[model samples]
Target: MHLRFHALATACACLFIAPTLRAQTTSPTLVTATTNDTSAEQVVVTATRGAKAVEKIPGAVSIISRQDIEAQGLVSEDPSALLALQIPGYAPSRQKLSNFGEGLRGRNALLLLDGIPQTNPLRLGGREGYFADPMIVSRIEVVSGASAAQGLGATGGIINTITRTPTEEGTRHTVELKYGTQFHGDSASWKTGYMLEHKSSYDLIAYLGARNQDIGVDGAGRPLATESLHRAADVFVKLGKDFGPQRLQVMFNRYQADGFDDRVDVPGDRATGVPTTSQRGTLPYDAPRNEVRSASLEWTHNDLAQGTATVQLFKQDFSARYSGGVIATFQDAAIAPVGQLIDQSEIQADKWGLRASWVRPDLWTRGLELTLGADYLDDESQQRLTQTGRVWVPPMTYRSLAPFAQLEYEIGPLTLRGGLRNEHSRLKVDDYSTLAYYGSRAVQGGERSASKLVKNLGAVWRFGNTGWSTFAAYSEGFGSPDVGLILRAVNSNGRSVNNLVDLQPILIDNREVGVTWRGSRASLSASVYRSHSDLGSQLVVSNGIGSVQRVPITVRGFEVTGEWRPLPDWQFNGSYAITRGRTASTAGGSLDLDLGARSQGPDKLVLGALWRPAPGWQAHWTQSVYFSRDANEGKFSGRTSLEEHFKGYTVADVALSWDSPWGKLGAGIENLFDRRYITYYGQANYSGTAEDYYAGRGRTLTLSWRRTF
Candidate 1:
C-alpha cells in the first residue's frame, strides 16, 4: 500500500509538470535585485552544506526573514513557537520554555547555532530550542524531514538560527523597549535591549548587543511560576575581519536567568481534568537558574584546492535547574519512615566541536557540484537532584566523528541531489548508584559504540518559465535512546549496562513528494510524506516520571500552504497540516494500534492577512485552528483511558505598526477575542494533574518602540 501511494503521488506530480517540459531547453534568467518584484531570492546553507537558492532545494524548507519576525511580535521566548506558526508539520507550541515533545515530522530535530549543535542527545533534556534570544537572530531556516546533510539528532530535520551581521561600512546603534500586559488584568512585563555595530573601511566589523527582561503573569492574573520566568539578561559580541581571499570571524554569547516564585500546585478534580493552583508560598526546592555560554571561531578561504573551504570551532556550556516537581518518592533510612517526593532535577552539559567543509561547483563536469565535510564533537552531560545533590542521570561523555559528501547534478529541467554520511560515536559512563525508590539500586556503567551510514536521494523538476516545480525525495535518519536514563534506572538485580542489549539505535525511513507553484501574485505549495521506523522510541510518562519505549510505528502526513496578493498593499497567507500515526502492538497476536496524543498531535490550520494601507503603516491579523482528535489508549479501556478528547478551537491575533521620526511604534493584541482555550498538550498528555494544564494565555496587549542611529 505504501509503495502504491508513493507511485501514485509521483505520477500525479509528473503529470502536473509535463506541460512546461518544452521550455526546459531555454536558458533561465536569474532574478536580480528589483524593488518592484514581490519575490526575493533566498540563499540557504543548512539544506545543501553550502549557499544555494531555496527554490532549487528538493525538500520541505521554509525561511522566516527578519521582517517576518518583527511583524509577528511573538511573545513566547521559545522560538519553536515561531516555527510552529510559520511552518507546516511543526507541532503547536506547548507555551513553556521546554521543548519536550515538540517533534518535527514525528521525530527529533537538530538545533544549530551558526552550524554548531546545541542538543545534548546523550542526556536528552529537551531544552536545546531556547538557547538564545530571538532579538539577536537575523533569520531562521527550517528543513523538514530526514536528510544526511546533518549528522546526529536530525531524525526530523534541522533548524538554524542565523545571527545578525554588520552590513554597511559605518557605526550604527539601535535601542528597543517593549511593555506588555493582560487586557483585563494587571499581569504586566517589560523588556529593553540595545545593539551596537561598527564596520570599518579596512574590512573589519564589530557587533555587540545586550538585553534584559522581567517575569510576567498568565492571562488569569496568576503569576506564572511553572512557566519559565523571564528575569534574564543576555549579551553577545562578534568580531570579523576580511583579508580579500580569506575571512575570519569570532563570536561569544552569555545568557543567564534566575528567579524564585512563591507558589505551588495542588491537585484538582480529576474527572474533568482541571488543574491545581496556588496563590503564594515558596516550595521546598532551589530557585530556577538557567545559564548558557558559548564561543566560536570560523575561518573561510576562497579558492582553496579549487574550491571554497570553511572551518569552524565552537564550545558551549549550558546548565538549567527545573522547578520542584513530584518526580519520585523514596524513603530515607534515617530521615523518614514513609517514602516522600523528591523534587528538582538540574542538567549540566558541555559541548565542543570542530567542523570543516569544502564546496566545489561544476567539478570536472558542467552542472555538477560536489560538497564534502567532516565533523568532530565531544559532549559531556549529567543530571542531578538540586535539593540533595544526588545523581539522577549519571555523568556521560560522548565523542563522535562524521564524514559526509553531497552531490548535485542538473540536466535540462531536472535537478538530482544525493548525499551519504558516516556517523561513528562512542559513549562512556562510570558506575553509579540510583536514587532510592523502594531501595537504592546499584548500576554498573560501561562503554557503548555505534556506527551507521545514512543516505539521501532527491530530485526536483522545474517547469521553466512557468514558475512551477515539483520534487520527490527519499532519506534515512538515525537516533539513539537516552542511554543515561536507561542505565541509571536499572531495576533488574545485578544487571550491567553492557549486558542490556535491548537498547539499540533506531533508524527511520522517510519518503516525500511535493509540488510548488509561484506566480507573480500567488504562490502555493503542497506536500505528502510518510515516515516509518521498525524500532522507534516513544516517551512514556507514568507518575510524572518519563521513560522511553521502543515500538514499531508509521506516520503519514500532508501539508498545504498558499499566499496571495490581491492588491499591492494587501497580502493573505494560510497553511494546513494533517498527521496520523499508528504503532504495532502484541495485545492479541500483533495488532496495529492507534497512536495517542502522547505520540501524535492534532491537525493544525493557520490563516492570516497583512495590509499596508498607507506609507510606513502596517496592520496584520492571524487565525489559528486546531482540529479535534480522539485516539484510544488500550491500556485504560475507558473514557479516562482515551487520553483527553481534544476539542477543536480557533484563536485570533492582531497587530499594527507605524513608522515615526523618533522610532518605530508597534502595538499588538494576542488572543484577540480573549477566548480561553486549553493547549493541545495540556488536553492530551499533561503528566501532572496538579499543574495548570496547557491553557492558552488570555488577551494580551503589547506596546513597543525602537530607534536606530
Candidate 2:
C-alpha cells in the first residue's frame, strides 16, 4: 500500500506541474541573489566576518527575506519552517527540532547571530534551530557550503542572522500584535520595539517579543507531535565614531529561548510493531532553556592611501538545557524502559576572535585582498547516565585555537578567491566515573586535537549586458567528536560499558562549481556540489568511547534555484535537490546498528510563489516534498550498502494576506492533501523507520494578524 500510494502521489505532482513544464521553453535562466537590485535588497552579512553584502563574496549564498517568514506559515512558530525551504541542498523535516534539540542535519550548517556564534560549543549539536525568533531579525544571510572561518567544524553552510539597527533619521518605535490558528489551534506573537539614533555617533534598536503556540497533535487528531512556548527579547546597540580617516564601532546583543514540546513518538516505532506510542518516557518540558550573549568591536579605514582595511574583535558566550526525556533501546523494557530525565547536556562556553582585512583601491597590490584572523574557544559540558535506579554525571572541558588567511584578486575578466585556515581544539573529560561492575574509572582526563586547512577559488566572466560565471571551490573542515562516544554505559544486564573514546573527529572536503546569469528581469544561480568524508563518525553500540570500528562515506548532491520577476509585483522562486549519502564499511564492528544517520533523508523538492495582486495585499504559496530510501540495519545484512528505491511524501502550504485596520491579516493551510510522510533522513532514531518515523501535520487552518505602528 505504501509503494502504491507513493507512485500515485508522484504521478499527481507531475500532472499538476506538467503545464508549467511544457509551456514557454525560453532560454534557461537560473537565478539566486543575496543583494537587492535598484531597490537593492537590504544586504548586510557576517558570513565571512564582513559587513558587506553576502552576494559580493565569491561563494554560493542565499537569503530568506522577512517577507517570506510569516507568508509560508510557521509550525509551532519556528522560523526554520520557512527559512530552510528557501535554500537548495538543505533537507528539512518536522522531526528536525524534536529529537536532536534543533533542526540540525549531518551536513552541519553553522548558525551565527549578527556576528556571534550560535552553536553550543560545549555540545556538538547547534541548538539555534529551535531557538530562532522572527521578531528580532531584520534579515537572514546564508553562506552555502564549508565555511572554516565561520566556525570550528562546518560541513553544511553558514547562516548569519542580522538584527535590525536603530533608527537612522526616522520614526523610532513600532509595535505589532499577531494572532493565528492551525486547525482551530492558536498561535500568536506580541512585539514592541524601538530603533533610534543615540548618543554621539551611536545608534540602538531594542525589542521585546513573546511567541506562543498551541500545538500537540496533527489536525487529524493523532498524538500531539510538537508543542512549546517561546518568550524572548533582544537589544542591539551600535556606536560609531570617526577617528581621522578611520571609523570605529562597537555592538552588543543578547537572545534567549525557553520552551518544551509534548511527547510524540516516532511513526516508525508504532509501524514496526514495537508499540511506538506510550505515555511513559515523556519529558515534563521543565528543563528546556537557552541563552546567547554576544558583543564585538570593529574599526574601518574609509580612506586608505592605497585601499581599504578593516579590523574586528568579538566575544560570545552560550548555554542551553534540554530535559531530554529517556531514549530507549528496543530491549530495555524492564525496570527503566521509560522515565523523565536528561540523558545529555552542555553547561556553557566562552569564545573570542579577531579579524583583519586589507584591499587595494588602485589595483597596485596585484589584485590582492588579504584577510587574516584567529579565535579561541573555552567550553565545558557534562552528561547524565541512568543506571539501576540512579543518575550519574560525567564532566568535560574543552579549549581551542585557530588562525586563517585569504587573498582575492581580479584581472580583466577573471576573479579568484582563495583562503586557508588551521583549526585545533582540545577536549578534556573530567571527574568521570561509572559503575564498578561495568568499568570502574576514577577521575580521568582525555584530550583530542583537530587541525585542517581550508581554501577557495572562483572566477567570473563579463560580457556586454549579460554575464556568465563559473567557479570551483574547495575547503576542508573538521567536526568535533560526539561527547557520548567516550562515556561508559551501564547496560540492562548490570555490566559496565567498555571505554570507547578511541574515536576521532569527522573531516570533510567539499568541491563545487556552477553557472549563473545576471540580468534585469531575472537572476539565476545553479550549482553542483559534493562533499567527501573519511574516518567520520559512525554509530556503534555507542559508549563513552569510539564506536566498535570505523568506516568512510561520501555525500554527493545537486541543487538548482532561481528567482524570476518578469512583471511588476509578480515573482517566482523554486528549487529542487537530489542528494544521496553513503558509507562503506571500514575497520570496526557494528556500532549504533548502522541504521542510517536519520539526518540523511532522500530527495527533496520545493516551490514558492509570491504574488502582489494589489498593493499592501499579497498571496503566497509553497509546497515541498521529501523522499525516503529504505534499508536494513547493519545486523540484518552484516554490513552497510546502498539500495535503490525512493521512499515517499509531499506537504503543501498556502497563505493569503491583506492590510487591515488593526494590522496585516492572513490565513493559511498545511498538508492540504492530508497525506502522511516520513523524513528523508529519519531524524527520530529508530522511530524514523517507515513504521515509527515521524509524520507531517494534517490539514491545518491558520489565521494571522500583523501591524506596524
Candidate 3:
C-alpha cells in the first residue's frame, strides 16, 4: 500500500535520461545592487535559485512582497487569512477556532521557508505555513506549476518564502506590536526581527513571535473555539568566505512552534437561556495539543570548474495529542473495552533528510545551463491508542531518495527551460502486533519501491518595444499516499482498516501553461493549469467509531489566474479553479467496497485587488463566492448545513496603511460585510462526511504599528 525502495532506485536511474547543458552566470547579485530603489518590486525568484526580473522567467508566477503584507495589516494572527486572498486555489480558513481544526483558509499552495518543505502528507489539504513570519520576509515567490527542481508535492504549485538577508549595503532594525478584535475575544501579537551585517562577508537574521487569543462560540449556540496559546522562534545565520574564482558560504536555520486549540463542547445549556453561539453545546471540550520543530544547514560552492555544488542536512518533527472526545460504548464489545469509555487518537513522527546538488553552466553553448541534485529522507512514526489509560503503538518507517536535473537556454529574445526527476521511495512496518476482531493490516511487514517521474518544459518570447511577452509551460507532479497512515490504519487502530481490503499509492500528474501582456498603461498575466491523479486517496467512509477508508479514484481540475496593474497605485488580480473527481474503478480489483460515499467538490473561485493611490496610504480588498452545489459526499446536506450545497456567498475586506517617520501604521477589516462561508470540510472520524466546515468570521478589525531604527 505504500511506496518504498522501488521508487528510490527508479528515480536515481532517471538521472541519465537528460542531455548536458551549457550556460554562464556566476553569482546571484543583490536586488538593490541592480535597481535604483525603483521597480525593486519586480524581482523574480524560484525560476532559478537566483534573481531575475519577472519578465525573464519562462513560466507563470506571482509575487506578494513584504510591503503588501504590512499594508494589509497581516502583522498579527491568522497570516493565512491574507494568503487565502492572494494565491489562487490555496485555501486556509478564516475562523481560528473550529471543530475539525484549521480548515483550508487560503491557498492550497505548498509552502516553504528558505528551502525546507512544510507540507503534511498525513493530514491532506490543510496548509501549515500559517505559522510563518511575514514581518521578516524579504519577498514571497509563487511558481504556478510543478518544476522538477522544486521537489515533490507541487501538484498544485509552489510558494517559497525567502527571508531577509543581511547585507552591508544597508543597516536597519524593525519591530512590530499589534492588537486586534473579532466578534468576541481580544487578540494581540508581538514580533521582533533583525538583520545585521557589516562590510565583511558575514550576515545574520532572526525572528521571534508570541501571540494569544481567547476564543468565543459559533452561531450554533455551542462553545466558541479558542486556540490555547503559541510561541515560535526562527533564526538563520550565513557565513560567506571568498576563495579564488569561487565564493563559499555556510548557512543554518532553526524553527519551533507549539500550541493547542481547546474546544469546550457545551453538552447542556439552560432551557430558558437564549441560544447564543455559546449555549448551543454544553459537552466537555475536545482540546488538541501539537508542536512542530525543524533545523537545517547548507554549504555552497560556485566554482567547482565542472559546476556549482551544494549540500544540506535537515531534521523536522511534528507531534500532536488529542484528548477530548465524547465517551462512546465500544463499537465492538466482544472484547473488554478496558473499562468501556473510549477517548482520543494521536500522530507522532520524526524525519531526517540530506540533499546534494550540482549545476554546470554552458559546457557547450552560451545561454545553456544544467543542474543535478539528489535527496535522501528517512521517516519514522508511531501510532497509539488510549484504552482505560493504556497506550499502544503500531509503528512504521518510510524512506525515500531522489535525484533531478534541469536545463535552460536563451537565443535572442527566446528562452526555454526543461527538467526531470525520479524518486525512489521505500516503506516498512516494525514491531506491529495485535487484534484481528478489529481488522486487516499490512502483513506484519513488507516493502514497496514505488518510483515516481516528474518533468517540466517552458518557453517565453518578448516582442520588442511593444511591451508584450508570450509564455507557455508544461509540467508534471505527483501527490503521494501517506505511508504512515496506511501502517497505522491497517494495524487495527483506525476503523475501516480493521476489516478492510487493500491499499495502494495515490498518484497525480499535473500540467499548466500561460501568457502575459504589459504596456506603459496596463499589464496582465494569465495562465491555465490542470491536474490528474489516479489511485487517488479519496475519503470512502467513516463510522462514528473513529474509523475511515479511501478508495483509489481519479481527481482532475483546471484553473486560470490574472492580474492587471493599470496604474502605479491601481492593480486588479484574481484566480478561478474547478476540480472534478470520482472513483476510477469499482467492478473488479484488489480493492472493493460500496463506498457509496462520494468524493468530490464544487468548483472554487476568488476575485480581489490591491489599490495604493499614494505612498502613506494603501487600501486592499477581496471577495470569495463559492459554488458548493458542485461538492460531493453530501457534506452540506446535514443539520448544521447553512445551505444545501453550501450556497455560494460573497464577503469583502479592506486595509489602509500609513508610513510615518516614527514608524508604519495600518488597519484593516476582514469579511467586512460579515458574509458566511466554508473554506474546507471533511474529517476522518465522528462525521464520516466532509461535515467539517471552517467558518468565515464576520466583520473584524486589525491594527498594527512598526518602527525601524
Off by over 4 Å in 1: 1-40, 74-78, 183-186, 201-225, 325-327, 334-342, 543-545, 585-591, 633-642, 686-688
Candidate 3 local lDDT, 157-235, one digit each (tens): 6777776666544455667776666645433334445544433444455555554444433333133333333445555
Write model 2 residue lDDT over 590-703, tens digit each, in one string. 222222544454556676666778877777767787656554333322332322233566777777888877767777766667655544433334323333444455666666
Tell how far residue 184 is off in model 3, in angstroms: 3.8
lDDT of 1 by residue, 1-709 (tens): 3434644563455345432211100011111110125242568788888888766777787777777678775343447667777766777777666777677867778888888777777777766666666677877777888767888778788888888888888888888888877743326667788888788943332333343333334445443435555466778887888888788999888877664465555444536745443345677777677788888999998888888999999999988888775554434545445446556888999999999999998899989999999989999999988777778888988888999999999889888999998999888878887777635677778888889999999888998879788888888887777776676566657766677664677787888888776677666666788888787776555655555666787888877666666678877777666777777543112325666665566777777777887998888887888888766545543223435467767888888989988889999887788765667777766353646465666677888888889
Candidate 3 residue-wise lDDT at 61? 62
Count of clashing pairs, candidate 3: 58
Model 2 scores a C-alpha lDDT of: 0.53
Better of 2 and 3 by TM-score: 2
Q: Residue 277: error of model 3 in Å?
A: 4.9
Q: Which candidate comes out best when scored by TM-score?
A: 1
TM-scores of all predicted structures: 0.91, 0.79, 0.77
